[model samples]
Target: MRKNRLKLGLFIPPFHPLYENPTLCIERDLQITQFADEIGMSEIWFGEHHSGGYEIIMSPELMVAAAAERTKSIKLGTGVITLPYHNPLMTANRLCQLDHQTRGRLLFGGGPGLLTADAHMLGLDARESRDKLDEGISVISRLLAGEWVTEKTSWYDLNDAHCHLLPYNGPGSLPIGVASAFSPSGGTLAAKYDTAMLCLAATSPDGYDALAGNWKIACDTAEKYGRTMNPAVLRCATDMHIAETRDEAMDQARKGFEVTQRYFANQTAHVANEGMDVTLEDLIERGEAVVGTPDDAVAQIRRLEEKVPDFGTLLLLDKNWATFENKKRSLEMMMRYVLPEINGDNVSRQKSFDWQGEHAEEYFKTFQQAAQRAFEKHAAQTEADK
Candidate 1:
């Protein structure tokens, strides 16, 4: 109902199959979260995958916990957890407990399993995925609203089982969300439950225009019930990377991003059995990509705002999966430079790369010598021979 403008979120891609060495990845994600908090970035969300290259793991709850532990002020979400795949009691309990744990710092996001492989992994028929989604969601919704839900179905049943756990967030609704990718069913379900909707997309405004149109269709279908459902919390993923120089940032981003994109495009290809061609320029023009220099990119984001008046959040795919160094650089650029400008929070002149890094290190070296002299004297005086 709170129609705040331009919320920022991040999508973490599965960088490795081994899932080894998440300490660095965790730190990097937290760093972005911390910075977003500092800069008043509105919200943050990660996603879920069972197997495949999306690497964050099969659990958005765990990743949400990780981010929650590191941040106090930002709204953390699952972007969406595939609801149909999990037991409703466990799933509802997790969302309730996490909401309690973070003092309601959680956003409950859900979706039917996107991947057929995901349904297969759980030994469920792919045909039943969406049906299970409805059933799973119904159980959670009832329990959260303090209904003594009898989970009576092929999937589940709970006689006299309900949440006395937490007070209802509102008279009629739980803090529920749904993820949809051009599926009319996803949108309609969100509306049916009065849950917020999180829509996922790869970059390419051309496709994005098409995609948002799909959401509108879902929204229109939801409108048949009327009487004013909430204003609708809708989100789109933006693949993001920002830096001092346009050319350098794009060059660094290209190889790493394309590799990550291929992983996703391939997953989508197999699941939907449909191939998609995603482009950088289309991403930029669509206003959902993580490319471009700070200046131009901010303008593009604003352009997206104009194009999609209902846009709620810009989810950034800021991960540079190739290396810690690249990932850290991407984070720094987004936080220190890109986020502020795009949020309209700062307008300082960013003549960053126009001046130089290599060309300017020498100048900083002279200042470093002066700083060292001043620091040594200050330390000697302050420590007093210790």
Candidate 2:
């Protein structure tokens, strides 16, 4: 099989236990981002959620800014900022400022708010959220590009509105990615706008299965719109937990696995509904979650790469699904072991073994001499005893 080389990232929804203090959760999240940077992770994505008690972060931009200030080199992104929840002008300006703050290390992800109750609380109809997202993205794109946006959408309006502080990366410097699950809308929008696709549900079997078709749709649509799409722009994310050994990984996952399921059940019915009836084995079999050692993680990633063929980044979904210590160890192992193996770092290690093989005869001669001396000494001792 061909080696699959890919960049690694974290999609920290920053999920915490409802019983745990939110402040502590947020602090740990910051520390994890720093850890990821230190370990050579290419990027870190923060999720924005409003209504979920566990997904307590109201703003990913703030989190990204906080993370960026604490780390260097690791690109920061919004797993998504629910476009429908904020006006385009505000969102654009904040992101542009973040781009500058992070020194052009910002990846902008925009999508419709996922929670129905969140939209409802904001006086937006559940049905209008997607439409609002589409419109908001369109407007935000213009504003970010230093264009004065003047338009009236049902959910929001912008008249002569423009962001004075454009992206530090330059005009159109913002790399916009649209979040999608099993739907084609994300691909369609990405193609039309020449943006990226954030396959948020890439871990799910249904999501994994849709990848090839989604890429096709995005490419064809991009060609039709006289634009070019890069396959590397596609980011596929999956849930994962790795330990020193497969048994340890599975046991640790089992410890807090049900709590995660319950969180999904109450806060994200769409995702929870699919797994509520299945066992952990079933979920792993379906490519919905990965809980094992580094070897298993490598195998699962290869499986995903084979399915998508050219997908770029593998984002590990961050949840409080294991003990905090185990979670840190898992990511460290990924960086130290799995990532290197996948990226062919082991080839360098193999060179030393090859050198040893080349000098095998010399090594064997030395070993034989040492053994003969030891045997002779033992014989002398035995003779003395006699």
**Candidate 1 TM-score, true structure as reference:** 0.75
lDDT of 2 by residue, 182-258 (tens): 87888988997888888988878778888878888999999999887876788888989998777888899885777
The lDDT values for all models are 0.65, 0.85
Tens-place lDDT digits, model 1, residues 1-386: 12454566666543542345656666666666676666666677766777664565567788777777778788877767777677787787778777766667788787776677777878888787777777877778887776776657877767877765753354234467777665577677877777776656534534456555656665676788673333336666656666667676677677665666666677765324423466555555546565656676566566555545646666775455335555556655656665566554543334555556646878889889999999999988989966
Worst 10 residues of 1 by lDDT: 166-175
RMSD of 2: 6.1
Off by over 4 Å in 2: 1-4, 271-277, 348-356, 359-386
List pairs with backbone clashes in candidate 2. none
Rate residue 220 of model 1 by lDDT: 79
List runs of model 1 lying over 4 Å from the truth: 1-3, 17-27, 167-174, 202-207, 229-232, 265-290, 318-386
